[model samples]
Target: MGKYIQQTDMDAYRFYLASMEKSLATIEKYLRDINGFCSFAGGRTITKELVIAYKEKLIARYAVASVNSMLAAINGFLSFAGYGCCRVRQVRTQRRAYCHANTQLTKSEYLRLVDAAAKTGDERLNLILQSICATGMRVSELAFLTVDALWAGRAEVCLKGKTRTVLIPGKLQKRLKQYIKRHKIESGPIFVTANGKAVNRSNIWKAMKRLCAAANVEPGKVYPHNLRRLFARTFYHIKKDIAKLADVLGHSRIETTRIYIMETGEEHVRIVSKLGLVA
Candidate 1:
């Protein structure tokens, strides 16, 4: 005996999220999650029982993290819509001490990816991969790598209502300058299509996937975010400072940065075995 959430209420919820300064990506994800729940409920009123049932359905189809993320969106919507009592519990996930081998892109593999891009004469692809790794910037933040930022030796990345300065290494600055001169890019984002629009995440992802075979790297390890993670690991290896790494990566939480530098299972075992407990 409950009432279905109205379209007007959904629109208002979207406006509320925007007012809270949620990033475009986050807002879209929240809306998508809420829409998914609405579809599942099929115009019925959302209740605790209904939400619990939906959680069970999601458990069968998605991973724990994804399910929790979806639940977060639903909970946010419920709070906004005066249905807090109906909010469902998120699935608890075990902490991961190590990442799977297939997803962990090694430094050697990263070099191979760059070499492969160069061999193919796809200069943009090559530089894009290098830029993310060198700067340790997220793929989405590449839009900030404009000619002006290059000249200044730092990119001003604004996302999720926060702005941060991402420095460009001196060597990378020289290369980027040369690339700009070679391409005759007067101003604006260096990475863009012929139409002058900044390349989107999906395009960048597909471009990296295309390089895997030529690079002789596993396809699973060739995504753009992995390049950022590679940067995190490399920086941590050299500096061994987690706080500094978090600041560089623009992460509010050091724990989030730790995830980026999490070792693979093989590396974890090697370190654990060195404890000398097996005398």
Candidate 2:
């Protein structure tokens, strides 16, 4: 005996999330996951068994991490709707030591993408790509990169109730200053559309995807987050300080930072081969 999930429950949950200071992106994702579960429920009374069944369905269709993410959303909503007994456990997965090779974006590929953007004369895209890669900032944090922050050499990014300072490299700072001057962007976000609103993640993602063919990079590897990973990898190789890198990337856990800096399987194999244990 459980209450039927109603649209009112969903609306209230959304408002609750917003009140808790959840980012708009996070709220939307949670709602999307909840909506997906609702469709699966098909108006059936919510129950633990039904939630488990939904979890299994998700596991079959999505990757383990994605499945867990969806489950997290459902669990949160259930707690909010007073259906905590219906919450289902996320599937367990071992942490991956190396990232999949197919998705790893190499430095050379990143430069080629930047060059391609320049060739297309999309200066905004070109700078956006570089800014994320160089600063290792999330695409969502780009809005914090205003002309004032550029002059100050660091941007204070606030997200998910946590604030972190992202430093702009000296070289990148000079380039962005020139861009700001050329565009007469006296204040506010450095990146914006014709309407002067901060550019959204979807637009940045699409712009990056369009450069794949021209850059000779795989479409799967062309994304805003991949640039952040490239930055993490580069920083780790040079500094060899995972803790410092974690701080820079605004990761609350070093484990999350480890995922960002994972090498491809090929690189992992090559390094393991050099151990001389076989000889």
Candidate 3:
């Protein structure tokens, strides 16, 4: 039988991921999933059967998307460790046609969140929320929202070996300029902490969460990424151009952009009913 997986292998895997230039968050999540599989293994020698069993357990407990993500991590680690024979296949599920309404952040809810931030004297959080929703940029891309970009009315965002230009809406540009001047921010990223470093994803997430109660918005629907989704949906509604939207959102595939603009099941039903096919 083959030998059991060891801590040394996990350590080496971390080094490999770093060398590959994986983001810190990506490395942490991959390692965390690998560790979970290790715990399930219980020191047993890795085998295809054991890996499949773990995959089944994950399927029973998590959403299909989540199960696939964990399996991807495990398969990646197994391949890196030269144990590719033990990797299990991921579960295949049909694509969803509509997004869950409960998780969707409406524009009204977003406005309320901004209002809540303003009432609480969190000027930075208010602007941060607007910046993301207005630009369709990722939360991680917030660092690229610099003073220079605001002046230029566009930002050049580079991530994952790809770069795209994000245009700043005229209204949003005016507002951000006022914020920069009021805050006395001379140069560099307009959104920064007291130490002048760009605010990271975790900090922005927590700050946004604190506004849920005051905003009367569901906590589940409030997050930085949702702001980006709101942007995509709004842009698609206005322009009705999926290809251009895909380019604006920096998506290599229009299929991905479609997910961002999917209507809720209720909205889908409403539109279908208006077709008046029934007597």
Error of 1 at 167 (Å): 0.5
Per-model TM values vs. the true structure? 0.93, 0.95, 0.95
lDDT of 2 by residue, 137-198 (tens): 99999999999999999999988789999999999999999999999999999999999899
lDDT (Cα, 0-100) at 203 in candidate 2: 92
The per-candidate count of clashes, in order, stands at: 0, 0, 0
Model 3: worst 10 consecutive residues (lDDT sum): 1-10
Candidate 1 residue lDDT tens string, 205-261:
999999989889999787888889989999999999999999999999998998999
Q: After superposition, how far is residue 65 of candidate 3 from its true place, in Å?
A: 1.5
Q: Which of 2 and 3 is ahead in lDDT?
A: 3
Q: Which pairs of residues collide in model 3?
A: none
Q: What is the number of residue pairs that collide in model 1?
A: 0
For candidate 3, write residues 94-212 as lDDT tens digits. Answer: 98988789999999999999999999999999999999999998999999999999999999988777889999999999999999999999899999999989999999999999999
Runs in model 2 deviating more than 4 A are none
- The regions of model 1 sitting more than 4 angstroms off are 18-24
TM value for model 1: 0.93
Better of 1 and 3 by TM-score: 3
